[model samples]
Target: MHSSNLRLEEPIRMASILEPSKPNFFPAMTKIVGTLGPKSRTVEIISGCLNAGMSVARFDFSWGDTEFHQETLDNLKKAIKSMKKLCAVMLDTVGPELQVVNKSEHPISLQADTMVVLTPDQDKEASSNLLPINFHGLSKAVKKGDTIFIGQYLFTGNETTSVWLEVDEVKGEDVVCMIKNSATLSGQLYTFHVSQIHIDLPTLTDKDKEVIRTWGVRNSIDILSLSYTRHAEDIRHARDYLSKLDGLDQTQIFAKIENIEGLKHFDEILQEADGVILSRGTLGIDLPSEKVFLFQKAAIYKCNVAGKPVVVTRVVDSMADNLRPTRAEATDVANAVLDGCDAILLGAETLRGFYPVESISTVGRICSEAEKVFNQDLYFKKTSKHVGEEISHLESIASSAVRAAIVVKASVIICFTSSGRAARLIAKYRPTMPILSVVIPQLKTNQLRWTFTGAFEVQYLLCFSSCSWLPLPS
Candidate 1:
């Protein structure tokens, strides 16, 4: 009777439609992605990292072999299970990187007036000690006396009457070739007047396709992080390959933006891509410093408009590898979160850094704090209307829908749009609830990767008739 009375003492309350399980807003938890490496390969260590804050772990395909990668992936899975967290594995590939094979043990230093030869020698690992400057086609594209940079260090002279070069005594393995002449580096095509033709690698290598297929068969990987993506064709081919994987034809693919071509074909890439990662390290070498910031900002705004989740990669400062991040670096991290990156990536910082725990914790703190400001501006903004429609009508509908989602305490607000215009407008209102925007086949859908700083749950439900709004997952 005492035990029965104790059971009967429990209060019973009727469920209410408007009742929300939790009042805290801002889309559940801020997604934190960390790259997996030697330092954090152990199951316990990886699990600790996941508990600390990492929500995603990227497996770099450019490094370890398949067997090693599989072992590591299994360890990560164990960690995820032990911690009881929903973690996603991202497959990062080594894209088409232009590298010079170097033969010299030490980096060759170039001093001004040092004549160097540009060769077609496959054996040569680095730039030659001396070479014949091809100025016959100087006026065609590259002129005399043009300063060319090799990797991040050396700068050689251009064509002049004498081809005399003051080379900076440089020393390094294969360095990336950079030309500076002031003729706007637009367009994807670059005419390098060299004796040897550049190597054109396949968008998806056989081994890469195999690993992607492995990802499908395992069903452990939730997201595919494609690196060095050059164009829409690359995304299309990747999608096709993924579709063939045992179980991954439908897995989410996040295109990593690290090259100029990828940026040029931003809209198309975004449309074809399921998500995006703004990898800054490789991108720094790919684009000029002045342009990188502006380009990143533009991508962010565009993604915001498209409602795709953008991941800001390479947040390296001293803090990433060191125990404490620099004040400026801390601010940089905060600014990206403010700029609307859905998540930020920690590469060597958490993988092989001295302070993986500290780095993860600090980044999480910065994201949490920055989100306050982001949320303030997000919820207050007005909705965008189509050209022919009444602005007031569109704005009113969007605001009302967002408010309804918020009051109902829905997990996600599902947006069904043919043109994706309604979703963008609704996103601008930025309800506290997550907005799962579903769009038909269109170019604008591709650009959404540049929009909101989160994930894009793309469902190819191409709306031929009706449009509706739904809530994101709780």
Candidate 2:
């Protein structure tokens, strides 16, 4: 997988990133991840978000094209330079989900209780308003009495509306579903399974692979969120693809748990991926609303035990209006932080929402407040544990540093190192003290952005005695 072209790019000279002191001031144990979209892609907006406490920038490829993503990457780099923040970038793949193919720009409205035919063809023109699907074996995979969700994707905006359908009949290539309710329609390749039928689909599409090879090979991303991950093998497959890319050694794989199959193989997938995302919107289609949040809690607990990055996503729904979050929404954010989720991801809220910055600030305020009352005994859980069992020097030092800080009641633990291994190990202990880690080679600093949950900051310090250098703006 190694590309010569990828290997040729000169490693960024360390001298350019050094600064006297740029404080990393996020004091909460949890981090905020804001997704980029049409609304939040500008350099000004992205820089504002990073300065306002957004630690990770997520780009979901499920909606945008390659050109759109490249623009986002460009803006994010500009923002990174503008804010002098080493924010991590997560490029999420579309994965294997079914969608609808609407050739017409106008949404052909369908009525309630109407009978419609579902075809798998994408290019075939529709007749009599028959909807076309992207999956070829759609009829074969479904049976009568099976539930089919006929969803509406608003083209004018990111808002989605959909109705349920019960499979009434199937004949050869056509599967007929009766609409349980009315819905507007406009989207691509839409489908969600209500049953336990997991199709044999490629983990990554051609487009997904292309992005990884191009952007990943070019060192444009920090992490890749593999979509629709059903098995641990899915994570392995994605990593297999990334292994060949040059300079992408730092790019980690994050598995997204959005379907029933993914949940079933949760532990295995969790261990395989760098982190996991509890995607509520997609999970809701498979499970009841109550069950979705319940699973989210359990998922968070499992990830904590494994010492991995676990994020609870799609929590704020009303932010689309740019209005203050409802009481329940506000409570949801606080609860997720209290539940030990390492991060809370804002989806449409930061993208299309009228108040993107306000939403980030709101979540930051809630998380900071929650961390103020966060009980270490309850959250970290003191159990009879093993220590110093074949631990590396860096790991051992991190543990000792954390203990020293706590014993002296030190407010901040400062560690100067070449790599971020010491900082990561300190984070694993869930220390009470803020970690101000000074690292070399800016890439390591960026990777460490997701390593610690507490008030952790990575300041790049490159001493180029052999070459001239300029410190970052004070």
Candidate 3:
């Protein structure tokens, strides 16, 4: 059903009221990314997520068809417009991912000294296997004495790496090798050359791009998230392709960083893309789990330094199906906020969950709370010199004043910021109250769309442009 068919209990802009004496309130701008799925497709559920502070709704093309996807997109637009919030939607495409073609249901269990035979014919599921190695490229990557790890079970042998072995006996279709640290049903496979295998598909799958284009024309989506991005070219290609569509150039493209290839070309990728997404779920499969956390942190730091928004996502909790998040899960949510990310994403938590509302509420609570302490230290500790000599003296004054207002709990901080530099400063401080920003030039409003404080109350003040508009040291 469309959002029009569903009723919202309250307006989407309604902010939660903490105790009157409480010192903290919501930050100036915090964007939440909620994935769309069975649980969240209903108008009521989608509204609940939005009410819980989701600024953007994402349609994961990996799961649904065109009809379902488009319908959901329409519903979100109706909901946001009805609520009078400038809503943003994102379309995420599933890229070329390696997979185990075919396998048996039985677990390929092995003990120490167990002799397993691998053959060419046994490797074939629906088609023919050209090589004898059970895995697609195990022989090429492994050596005669090299250690072989099969789902935490190790095997070493004197047999030549390339030598073909006949399946002397079979316990199941093939031995499940490299079972992850967690016993996930999504099996892992060893392969050579980890890169995007062109699936002869549109950068945005045919179905997905159509929906994105439609949403763009209607101003439904503000961001286009490219999943499985490998190089700078991917971002360029997406931007160019989308540029051909009407009213879509305003929609920014974000490259989802998941694989090693994307990380190796980080700088170039960041330049070509508007933002980045730390998609840890697929990343965990491609890399060791231990490394994912640090890699995510580095990505966040890079994005923040570059003034780009970054979204950290994955199974931050089991609440996708349960109401309450585990204690550890709560801490994980807090950590993402403390890391200074622009947004934290909820996948199954909001999409296919039993307690969608509760999950969003918990995430909102943790992020809003953590942002208070982290942002305060981050912004207050910086010196005026660190703000750069480039900022005119007056802009700096406006920025400092806004920060002071937040520190003192002013009902509203009215800022006369032209370049938006002043507002960004106020936003970085994680002010507890709303900021009523008065911009000198009307065009400057567009530039602040993604900035920390641009999201606050935007009002245009009458004035002509001037280089000396900001106070100078002289």
Provide the overall lDDT of each model, using Cα atoms, as 2-decimal numbers.
0.56, 0.68, 0.55
Total clashes in model 2, counting residue pairs 3 or more apart in sequence or in different chains: 8
- RMSD (Cα, Å) of model 3: 12.4
TM-scores for all predictions: 0.64, 0.81, 0.65
Q: Give the best candidate by TM-score.
A: 2
Following a full C-alpha superposition, what root-mean-square deviation does model 1 have from the true structure? 14.3
Runs with alpha carbons beyond 4 Å of true place in candidate 3: 1-29, 99-220, 285-288, 380-387, 391-398, 404-409, 414-432, 436-474
Return whichever of 1 and 3 wins on lDDT.
Answer: 1
Model 2 TM-score is: 0.81
Q: Residue 190 in candidate 3 has what lDDT? A: 21
Candidate 1: list runs displaced more than 4 Å: 1-28, 100-199, 375-401, 404-474
Q: For every model in order, what is the number of clashing pairs?
A: 50, 8, 3
Better of 1 and 2 by TM-score: 2
User: Evaluated with lDDT, which candidate comes out highest?
Assistant: 2
